[model samples]
Target: MTTASSVSRGRSGWGSTAVAVLLVAVMLFPVYWMLNVSLQPGGGGAVASPWLPLHPDVSGYAKALRDQGPHLLTSLVVSLGSVVVSLVLATPAAYALAQFRLRFTDAFLLGILVSQMVPGIVVANALYGVYSDLGLLNSLPGLVLADSSTGIPFAVLVLRAFMATVPGEVVEAARVDGAGELRTFWSVVVPMSRNALVTAGLFTFLFTWSDFLFALTLTTTDDVRPVTLGLYQYIGSYVQDWSAVMATAVLASLPAVVLLLVAQKYVAAGATAGALK
Candidate 1:
């Protein structure tokens, strides 16, 4: 009945909401600024862009599409290829690590964890010599393989966590029906773990899509450039078209943003399902 303590709690709750909103606004400000700049006429000509795009323009986007279209396609191919490779390799590995009592399983998992701690530059340098020897430099296949290095490990961990929670009795029941391990996995486990697969696949796509390091390291030609590395066109001693740069960035960000928004439910389900494991 409007007690003093209830009133105080209500005010505190609103205070927390206000603070959260403020924090979100602060973090999202740069994204808003990027959008504003992308819409401005010629990026407002070296002056700070105004808070809003009172006069929106599309020329920058047109130019960006003209110049970066191939790069965007290349990135799409590489990111999709990396997702396929990562899932194909990681799913079995994760299943084995999750279910099998193999020797060195824990040690192998530890090794994978340690691999994540290694610096990307070190891995890139190591791959550089190998790729040069193998004549893989500037090749799309080389970039796909290189980007999958990051995707595989992460996919394995996520998939393993979810697979670990899969009921052993379900697998056993499949075996009782004369289903081979591979068949059982495909027929039973895969369908049940769709959320985890989506989660892993989307993340792999994001990783490979944004992978500037591998693209820069493995590619030396314009023929196979991904959009992340192609962003270099906007930067140089002679560059002055900030609008083009911002437009390119905005375009580059679209796929990941769209994927996250679309698959957010699957991602959340996969994450919470894996928590106990």
Candidate 2:
């Protein structure tokens, strides 16, 4: 009976593994196709074979490099700046909401939720006039601030949930040691919530990096263009450059791919641990 049960369990585990593998393949099909198209010879994405790149060409990548390199750097700068701003503002606000129990905490959180519900286009339209007046249009700082709108509320929600799980006794112990609230938060709470902070920062980076709407509306000239807009411009009104477009897309996707691979463990932990209690 023991041997029979062992054999059954082994079969079940193998079956589950097969299902997981199939699911991953299904999810990765688009990425595989993008790579395939990028590697094809300059035929505007119309390759003779779909399965493999029989004639790989590097000219597309060369063109993309020449055209989109500055845009990619601009994206990196804005994304990093947005992450910094979001974390700086959200960390303290999240801690307050998690620990302070102020009378308007619920209202404040509700406001955040409402902000998320507002459409991105609406926000962009509203900010355009403000940015024009402030002379922030077509600038990196303007893009950073606009992108932070996408990150800050989500970070606050995630960080607050995780921060709430921090042991009350631990915080009390730090206070008893004569640590002021700010010092305690900086030294103890921040260290304890490192995983959540990393996870929040990762998401913030991705959000800002992938942002196209704000980049489109906020920047008027090529002086401050991001990779997303640069990629969009590859398809002109008369003709489309599919090879260069796909190459640029692949290059743009690299940061997100690398980030997920590097910080996936922290992401999973934060998602599980930050479950609303």
Candidate 3:
């Protein structure tokens, strides 16, 4: 009986492993195809095999980087800038919401959550008008502001939940030592919530980096246009260069992938901590 049971368990384990491998392959096929197409050398109306590149070349990457001009750089700048600005502004606000009991605090928090429900496209026309009126159209700062409006609420909510997990005793002790609110927050609360902060920043970075609608509608020139818009430009009305499009797509996805890989541990920890608390 024991031997029979062991054999059955072994077969079950093998079956599970096979299924897992198949699932992974299915998920990864699209990414493989994207890379394959990106490396292929062919223009529109050129029939190229999808599985393998007929003429593998780096011209697509070169075009994406060089001929594409400062758009990639502009995207990097806007994404990084928006994340930093949102984190800086959101952290203290979150800390306040988490730690203090202000009048209408609940209402304020609700308002922030409600703002996220408003679709970006619905407000694009109004925002464009506002940007034009303020001379902020086609401006980096304006783009940052537009992205931040969406980013700040989530940042605030996530960091606030993380901040709530911190022991109030630690904060009280800091205040007893004559530390002011800012000092206590800087030295005490900030350090304890580093994992949460990193998680929030990573989330903000990914959202701002991937944003296309806002970036396209708000900015007019290549100077402020993000890689999303730049990639869109490759697809013309009459024809589309699939290879270059795939190459740009791969390149645009790299930063978010790297950021997630690096910060995954913190993200997990922050999530677990928030849930347990």
TM-score per prediction, in order, is 0.96, 0.91, 0.92
- Candidate 1 global lDDT: 0.89
Candidate 3 global Cα RMSD: 2.1
Give the root-mean-square deviation of each candidate in angstroms: 1.5, 2.3, 2.1
Candidate 3 residue runs with Cα over 4 Å from true position: 44-47, 53-55, 237-240
Error of 2 at 8 (Å): 7.5
Candidate 3, 155-226: lDDT as tens digits:
899898889888899999999999999999999999998888898888888888888988889988766788
Model 3, global lDDT? 0.83
lDDT scores in order? 0.89, 0.89, 0.83
* Range of the 10 consecutive residues with the lowest summed lDDT in candidate 2: 234-243
**Candidate 2 structure quality by residue, lDDT tens digits, 10-128:** 99999999999999999998888878777766656444436887778877788889889999999999999999999999999999999897999999999999999999999999999
State the weakest 10-residue window (summed lDDT) of model 3. 42-51
Candidate ranking under TM-score, highest first, comes to 1, 3, 2
Residue-level lDDT for 40 in candidate 2:
67
True-vs-predicted CA distance for residue 166, candidate 1, Å: 0.6
Instruction: Give stretches of model 2 more than 4 Å off.
Output: 1-20, 47-50, 237-240
Q: What TM-score number comes out for model 1?
A: 0.96
